[model samples]
Target: MRFALVGTGLMAQEHIRNLALMPGNIVAALVDPEPASLAWARRSLAESFGPATAEIPDFADVPSMLAAVEADAVIVASPNFTHHDVLLLLLATDLHILCEKPLCATIADAEDVVARSGGRRGIFWVGMEYRFMPPVTRFIEDVHAGQVGTLHRLALHEHRFPFLPKVGDWNRFNRNTGGTMVEKCCHFFDLMRAIVRAEPVSVFCSGAADVNHRDERYDGQVPDIIDNSFTIVDFDNGVRAMLDLCMFAEGSEEQESLVAIGDRAKLEVGIPSGIKTLSPRVPLGAPKAVTREHVAVGDDVLAAGHHHGATYFQLRAFLDAAEGRAPVQVAARDGLIAVAMGAAAEISAREKRVVGMREIRA
Candidate 1:
C-alpha cells in the first residue's frame, strides 16, 4: 500500500524509517508547511530506504498533496492542534487514516471525530506504540493469561528526559499540545485501558511543571507542561492503576517500568531492559519461584525507531487491518476515552480534586 504522511516532523521521520523496514509500503508524498522539516524528511527517507526515496513528491499541505498524489493510506503525524482539521479532510475521503495518539487536543474535538466516524469504509486506527512494545506486549499477555491471576493493581512508571524540541517549540504550550498529560501520557492511559479492559471511572493526579522549562521562555511565557506527576486511575472493573511520571530523570536506566500485582503472583517488566520477571505466590518459608527472561527484538527493528521498535510492529498490524485481514485494534472511541482520561488527569492536577470520567464525557 502507498502511504502519504501529513506532517514531516520527528515522528513522521520515524514512520519513514519504520516503513523502510516493512518493504511493502511506499511513501508516496510528504506534506509539511515547514520547508526545513520537509527537506529534513527527504534526507531521512533517502537515508532510511535509498537515494530513490528522495524523489518522492512533496507538498506544502494535505490538500495540495491530495490534489497531486494518490495514496492508499495517510498517516497524521502533524502537530497536536492540527489533528482535528487534518482528520476532518481525510475522514471525508475513503483513505485509511492512522492518526497519531492523543486523538485531538481537546475532548470536544475528539468527541466530534468519534461521532462523525460512525461507519467508514476505510480503516481508522489510532497510533499507540506502547501496546506494541515487545516486552510490554509479553507482560500484558502473561497478565491476561492468568500469570497474574485475578489482577487488581498495576503500576506504570516513566522516568525520562524532558520533551524534545519540536519544530516551533509547540510542545512547550498546553494550548497547542493538550497539556503534558494528554499529549504525552495519553499513551499510558490507553495502555491501562487496554490491559484493564475497562473504562476509567475517576482520575486523581498530582503534577506540576516544577523542574523542566523553568528557565526556558518562548515570548516571555514559561512552559506550562508538566515535568513530574503521579496519576491514579480507577477502572470500572475495580482495578486500580497508577502512573508515576518524571520527565527530569534522564539518568534513569529504564525509561519505563511496569508492574502488575494479583492474587496468585506478581509480574514486572522494564523497557530497553526488555526483561520480564514473574514471581508466583510462595508460602512464607518456601523458596522464591521468581523467573526472569528477555524478549529480544532484532537490532535492525530496534534501529527503526524509538519505543523499542513498536512503530514497526504497529505499522505491520495497521497494514493488516487496512488490507481486510484484521479489525482496527485501536479505534476512535478508544482514542477518545484515552484523551478523556488524560484530560481528567490534567483537570485533577490543576483543581486539586478527583475528576470523574463521567464529568469529562458529560
Candidate 2:
C-alpha cells in the first residue's frame, strides 16, 4: 500500500522506520510543518530504504501531492490539537486514516468525525496500539477463557518523565494538548475497557500538577494541566480499576505495569519486558511469563510506537481494512469512549467528585 505520513516528530520517524522495514508498504511521501523534520524523514527513508522516496513540506497543502501520489492511506501523527482538523480533512479524501490516539481534543470534534464517517468506504482507525500488544492480547484472552475465572479488580500504573512538548509546539500547553489524561493516558483507559470487556459505568479521580509545576523542567511555565492522577473506574460487570499516572518520574524506562485479579487467578503485564503470571489455574504455585518477541525491545513499536508494537499492528490493520482484508481495529466510537474516560478523570480531579461516565457521554 502507498502511504502519506503527516508530522515528522519522533513518533513519526519511528513509524516511517517500521513501515520501511515492513513488507508490502511504502512511504510515498511525507508532509510536515518542520523543514528539518521533513528532511529527517527523507533522510531516514533514504538511510533505511533509499532516496527514491519523495517528500513534501506540509500536508496542509497536500492536495496536489495526494493527486500525484495516489496514496492508499494517510497517517496523522500531528500533535493532539491538530488531530481533528487533519483527520476531518483527510476523511474528505478517499484515503483511509490511521491517526494517533485521543482521536480529537474534545468530545464535540470526536462526534464530528463519527457523524461524518458514517457509511464511508474507507476505514478510520485511531492509534490505540496497546490493543495490539501480544501480552495484552493474550491477557485479555486468558481472562475471557476462564483461566482467570470471574474478573475481580484491576490496577494500572503509568509514569513518564515530564512530557513537556517543544515550547512553541501547541501540545506543550493544556488547552492544545487536551490535558495529560486525554493526550497520554487514553491508551490505558482504552486498554482497561478492552481488558474488562465491559462498559465503564462511572469514574472518580483526583490529581494535580503540584510536582511538575515546581520542577525546573517547565522553566516556571507549566501548562494549566494536571501531571499526576489517581482514578477509580467502575465497570458494568462489577469490576473495579484503580489507575495511577505520574509524568514527573525520573526513570530510564517509562513506567507501565498492570495487575488484573480474578476469582481463579491473576495476571501482571510489564511493558518493554514481558508479562508475568501468578495463576492458580496452573499446575504449580509458580508463574509463567510471555514476552514481546516479534519486535525488538526499544524498537519503534515499543517506545515511540505506543504500547509495544501496536503502531505496526495498527498500521497493518488500517491497511488491511483499507484494502478490504479486515475490519476496523479501533472504531471512532471506541476512540470517543476512551477520550470521555480521560476527560472524566480530569473533571473528577477538578470537581473533587466522582465524574460519572454518563456526564462524559452527555
Candidate 3:
C-alpha cells in the first residue's frame, strides 16, 4: 500500500520508519510547509527507498500533494492545531485516513470530524497507538478477560522527559498543542475509556506548568503547557481512573505504568520493562498467589519508534482494515471522546473545579 504523509515532522518521520518496516508499504508523497521538515523526511526515506523509489515527490501543501500523488491512503501527522483544517482538505476524498490523536484539539472540531467522517466509503482511523503497545495490549486483554474481575479502579502513570522540540516550537504552547492534556494525555484518557468500558462522567485535574520550558520563550511568549498533572476521571460504569503525569522524571525506570484493581484481582503493567503482573484477592495472612511475566516485543520492532512498536502494529492493522481484512479498531468517535475527556481535564485544571462530561459534550 502507498501512503501520502501530511506534515512531515517528528511523528510523520516515525510513521515513515514504521511503514518502511512493512513488507510492501511505501511512503509515496510528503506534505509540509517547512522545507527543513521535508528534508528530514527525505533523509529518513533514504533509509529504505531504492533507486527507482529515490525521487519521492514532495509538496508544500496537502492540495498539491493530492493533485500530484496517487496513494491508497493518507496519514495526517500534522501539528495539533492544524488537524481540523488539514482534515477538511482530505475529508473531501475517499482515501482512508489515519489521523493522529486528539482527533482535534477541541471538542467542536472533533465532533465536526466525527460527523463528517461517519458515512465515508473509506475507513477513518485515529492514531491511538498506545492501545497497541504489547504490554498494554496484554494488560487490557487480561483486564477484559476477568483477570481484574469486576473492575473498580485504574491508575496510569507516565513519568518521562519533557516534550521534544518541534517544528517552529509549535508544541510548547496550549493553543497550538491542546494544552498538553488534550495533546499528550488524550492517549491516557482513551486508554482509560477502553479499560473501563464506559464513557467518562466527570474530570478533576490539578496541574500546572511546574517544570520544563520555564526558561524558554518563543517569540516573546512563555510556554503555558502543563509539565505535570494528576487527573481523576469518573466513568459511567462506576470505575474511577487517575492519571499521574510528570514530565521531568527522565531517570524513571519505567516510562509508563498502568494499574487496575477490582474485587477479584489486581493487574499491573509497566512499559519498557514490558512486565505484566496479576495478583488475585487472597484472605488475610494466607499465601499470596501472584504472577509476573515479561511480555516480549521483538528488538527490531522496538527499534522502529518510541511507541514500543505500536506504530508499526497499528499501521499493519490499519492496512488490514483498509484492505477489507478487519474492522477499524479506533474510530472517529473514539477520538472525539478522548479529546472531550482531555478537554474536560484541561478545563478542570484551569478552573480549579470538576468539569462534567456533559458540560464538555454540550
Candidate 4:
C-alpha cells in the first residue's frame, strides 16, 4: 500500500519510519506547508528507507499532492486543528486514512466526517495508539470472554511530563490546539469506551491550568486552557469511569494506568506494558499484606521507542488493516466516540455541570 503523509512533523516522521518497516507500504509522497520541513523529511525518509523505487516529492497542499501522488492511503498527521480540512480533502478519494487522534477539532466536524464517510470504500482509522497496546487488547479480550465477569467501575490516570514544542507553538496553549482534553487525553477516553463496552451517558469535569501556563511558557497571545483535569463518565450499563489527565506531573514518565474492577476479577493494565491480575483479598483489621502475581509484556514497546511503542503499533495496524490482513484497531467510529467524550468534558468544564453525551449534538 502506498501512503502520502500529510504533515512532516515529528509524528509524521515516526509514521514514515514504521511504514519503512512494513512489508508492502511505502511513503509515496510528502505534504506540508513548510517547504524546508518537507524537504528535510523526504531526504531523511529516503536515506532511512534505502534507495526508493521512485523519487520523493513534496507538495505544498493536499489537493495538489493527491493529484500528483498515486497513493492508496494518506496518513493525516497534521496538527489537531487542521484535521477537518485535511480529512475533508482526502475523504473524497478511495484512499484509506490513518488520522491522528481527536478525529477533528470539534464534535460537529467529527459527526460530519462520520456521516460523509459512512458508506465510502475507504476506511478512516484514527491513530489512537493506546488501543493497539497488548495489555489493552488482552483486557478487551478478557472483558469480552466473561473472564472479568460483570464490569462495575474503572479509573484512569494519564499524566504527561511537560514536553511542549517550542517552534510554531500552539500545543502549549489550548486555544488553537483544543487543550489537553482533545490534544492529549483523547487516547485514554477512547480506551475507556472500548473497555467499558458501553457508550458514555453523561460526563462531569473539573480542571485548572496549574502546569506550564506561566508567563515564561505562555506566549502572551495564547489562551490558557486547563492543564490538569478530572472527569467522571457515567456509562449506560451502570459502569462508572473516572479519568484524570495531568500535564504537570513531576518525576513521571508520561505514565498512564487503568484499573477496572469487576465481579469476578480486578484487572490492571499498565501503559507501555502488559496485563497484571490483582487478586481480591480485602485487607483485614490488622491491614492485610496482599500480593499475588505480576506479569509484564514480552514485547519491548519501550525499547522500540517513540511514545511507548504506540507509534509503531498504530502505524503497522493501519497498514495491515488496509491490506486486508487485520482489522483497524482504532477505527473512525472509535475516533468519533473519543472526540465526543472530550468535547463533552470541555462543555462540562465550561458550564460547571454534568453534560449528557446524547445532549452533545454535532
Stretches of model 1 off by over 4 angstroms after superposition:
none
lDDT of 3 by residue, 202-233 (tens): 99999999879999988888899999999999
Enumerate residue pairs that collide in model 4.
Answer: none
Worst 10 residues of 2 by lDDT: 289-298
TM-score (all chains, Cα) for each model: 0.99, 0.88, 0.98, 0.90
Q: What's the C-alpha lDDT at position 190 in model 3?
A: 90
Q: Which stretches of candidate 3 lie over 4 Å from their true place?
A: none
Window of ten residues with lowest summed lDDT in model 1:
113-122
- Per-residue lDDT tens digits for candidate 4, residues 1-362, read 87888988877776776666666777888889887668667766875587663377778899999788798888897888889888888988889988988788787788878877767678778888887666666666766676556889889887767646733665766655666777777888888888887889999999867757566545456446777889999999899999988778855743777777788667676654443555453545555443333334434444444665667777777767877888767777788889888888888887899999888774
Candidate 1 C-alpha lDDT tens digits along 1-362: 99999999999989999998886788999989999999999998889878998679999888888889989999999998999999998998889999999899999999999987767888999997799998988988998998999999999999999999999999999999999999999999999988888889999999999989899999999999988999999999999999999999999999999999999999999989999999999999999999999999989989878879799889999999999998889999999988999999999999999999887886
Residue 306 shift from truth in candidate 1, angstroms: 1.4
How close is each model in CA RMSD to the real structure? 0.8, 3.6, 0.9, 2.8
lDDT to native, each model: 0.92, 0.76, 0.91, 0.76
Where does the lowest 10-residue lDDT sum fall in candidate 4?
A: 289-298
- The top-ranked prediction according to lDDT is 1
Provide the lDDT at 225 for model 4.
Answer: 72
Residue 75 displacement (Å), model 4? 0.2
